[model samples]
Target: MTYKLHKLLPAGAAVVAFATMMTNAAADQIVKIGHVGPLTGGSAHLGKDNENGARLAIEEINAKGLTINGQKVTLQLDAQDDAADPRTATQVAQKLVDDKVVAVVGHLNSGASIPASKIYSDAGIVQISPSSTNPAYTRQGFKTTYRVVATDAQQGPALADYAAKGLNVKSVAIVDDSTAYGQGLANEFEKTAKSLGLKVLSHDATNDKAVDFRAILTKIKGENPDAIMYGGMDATGGPFAKQAKQLGLRAKVLAGDGVCTESLAQLAGAAADNVVCSQAGMALEKMAGGAAFSAKYQKRFGHPIEFDAPFTYDAVYIVVDAMKRANSTDAAKILAQIPGTNYNGVIGTTAFDAKGDLQHGVISLYNYKAGKKTLLDVVKM
Candidate 1:
């Protein structure tokens, strides 16, 4: 609910850690972990939050002086900027592979992560994504790919159920950015919403780069749907929301994890208030390391933490801990240890199922209230 930041120690410490990683590789050692995300693009803010969360975990684990396999090892986090672009993500991942990281923490968006994941898997590296919810990632049968957050298949339906039951909306319009994550979620929502007896008015699509939504909004308005659901990240989401409102569609807007970031609120302005969004993890207001991480993040970055930060933070720990538990950083060993993991994460108990899915995970609905996306409620499955 609140945030505070401690004064940052000089960047010299990280420089020293990087030095240690370059020269030393023995006992009293540092375990280098690489995390990649769109650190400089339209979704850059979300990527920074994801990286910060991972850094916070590394700092905490190092503070604990965690002893694993009878070695006093420290955690060292190496972050890469993927720019939210698929090709750039692959390049960042290749750099991480060359570094020979004990494990990899991310490729935040599905579009970027999917291709980068192929690189990691081919390199025999274990990768855990906090935000890449596209089902195709796990279905690929690559033992190295795992997801910390629940899949879009789960998130889409939870929002669909809310739109049908709580909002009592009969006609719903669907829109998506056509990215792997966006299209996957939009498809799931459309299927589930229609199965729930709601009328599917108009199904439209957009790209992350396209700005003008007047035509789609006009069509949706003509359809007179009770609500509009968007399947995209905040970058496109904020504009879509603002445009929808500006075009006088007025139908309640709903979206999945992609649109749950704070930047969306800035884009939609007052229009953001009426939009209902669903996210894959617990709200920063209520989670295992929620408050502490938020405070630390604000101190370091001078801003509030985004919604997906906890999962990213926990994912870092999960990869490191699993590697340590496996006794060897062999990709197969680390990958095998992920299933049925029960580590206490910043988001609470972290566990994965046989299908490489989080077991009994939770999803939450957020309403932008008082200039914030407060946790309206949670839906778990």
Candidate 2:
């Protein structure tokens, strides 16, 4: 009987120890954050850049360990691809809401972000866009919608001011891809150009998917405007500039942040030199921690940034910052804390106003020289 009792005691202790291990494992919680972007379309490179930024942040956060409400938590990134389409974006938004993500960071395009904002607002999820810059996005009165980049209202005027003052241009022609972002920026530019006393030669509209701009370029060539402003992404803007150069159109190409990317030189070739563009934030090299972030990013991703990575990277930290301040993983609590955020991150000091827009926005202007993007000026608005 003593021998049997001794054998059973060891088994009983092992079972008790196993139960304790299970309790400890169950104490750790999983917190998911959704990130949506176009991962399969023309803008896939930029979308992937945004996703990678968020992913890197999540990995780092998890490695360092996070505790919320006294419960150990592991961060998970739930990334979705919207293909840069408005309809797809809404679907992706719904999926994230259904997944019950604590927060979301994405829908990079203004067309995608604007429509997706309503769904997120309804779900009470905080949606932070790192690249969407259309003014109407924040003006829709959705308290949940926020962006790290400046709006077209500021970006367009900055580019127009540079064209009129720095380029010394007398007349300009305008072209837009007819999407929400492109047309909105072109409209703002037209308004400011007229205000600056620059002659408006003509304004033309094209679809975002269009590859050939020869017809528009030919028309503008006849008008012989001093410069041409293109409102579209680099996928189309590069081809537009290339076709214009091929047609012997000498007008300098002016574009917004969508066209300002590290890949532009490869797309536009020699014609890249004729392009002047505006990015809706501080230049990467000028960001407070830009150099260090760039090196770390390159080492991790094996490639340079495509323009929006830094913004998105800072966005993840801002979200985590709100989480820390709220002291809880509840989405509502995090959302409530975001409006009062005054985080000094990689992109510089970030604070949002009543409309969820950055309180102090900066636009960086660049001109391509010898097939490379060169900084021209930085304007604070």
Candidate 3:
């Protein structure tokens, strides 16, 4: 070695040697999984919850030492903030595609998911939406789209049935956040509500970013409906409920999975007691691995689970499972494998129907009492 140093290597030899060493250090094949949601707005908490789910799964997969075709692979998450806006969602979607991510896990709201789906389809990337419940998301005939939860087609009817038959309500008023998730669910619920012999008093529109719902609430209050159905996320839903209580409204607040988050209690405060919500899946206590998953999630994220974390967690596994079946990290191969997804995940047996929707989706009804979500019933569809 002393003699070799005396001979003096070429001027660029040291640089070349350093580059080779760095290359060897990063020899593991990296598979990028993109996660999109509103990480910095009113629904930021819910978006972060979804991101954490994907994060936990990626960490677990990497720790377990994933290998495909004898090549060690490291799972990497490329989380993007869409701010629950469709235009921003498409921008994030295009960025992920340009970055060559193998799969995508989000766009939590149906409004974001539906428009962003086209970008993923054009790029031949697999997109598994965890919380978007609008039926139109999967009905677009894009082979690249899939969802882990039930669609609004099922969720809306279940909520309407509960209101009409379970609560025995005679008349109801509806308010939507004007996003696809809100508007679609409201329309479906309105359809089923009318068919079930309940009088529909009024259906009003509210933007997702509107914090002051006093005007709409006052109008609905005057209608004297037995219940008020809201089709929006917990951000708006919680405030709507709280304001309704403040306005001395006697009508109970009802909503779909958009408002079924655990944070609803905190946001709505005392008004949470009057809020009832529905989720597009079974309650956590009734899920196959819900207890264990929730425990692990809390330990890792330092927070309680939100509504669709389990579904997003399972979505990560589904993407990895498709990769495993294909024995490759190619996006097209993974996309081809998604249609046959029959994974037994934390949410139960997740299988896609002809339209890439969950085949055996279940809807669970929940009510907030003492600032906690209590399960009422699980309706299998």
Give each model's whole-structure lDDT.
0.83, 0.94, 0.93
Report residue 319 deviation for candidate 3 (angstroms): 0.7
* Candidate 1 segments whose C-alpha is farther than 4 A from its true place: 1-28, 329-332
Write model 1 residue lDDT over 223-289, tens digit each, in one string: 8899999999888888888998888886999998888878777888888987899988777667866
- lDDT of residue 261 for candidate 3: 82
Per-residue alpha-carbon lDDT of candidate 2 for residues 32-101, written as tens digits (9 for 90 to 100) = 9999999997899999999999998888889999998788999999999999999999999999999999
RMSD of each: 10.7, 2.5, 2.7
Question: Which clashing pairs does model 1 show?
Answer: 5-299, 38-84
Clash totals for all models, in order? Answer: 2, 0, 0
Ranking by TM-score: 2, 3, 1
Which ranking of candidates, highest lDDT first?
2, 3, 1
Model 2 segments beyond 4 Å from truth?
A: 1-27
* Least well predicted 10-residue stretch by lDDT in candidate 3: 3-12
- Candidate with top TM-score is 2
Per-candidate TM-scores read 0.89, 0.95, 0.94
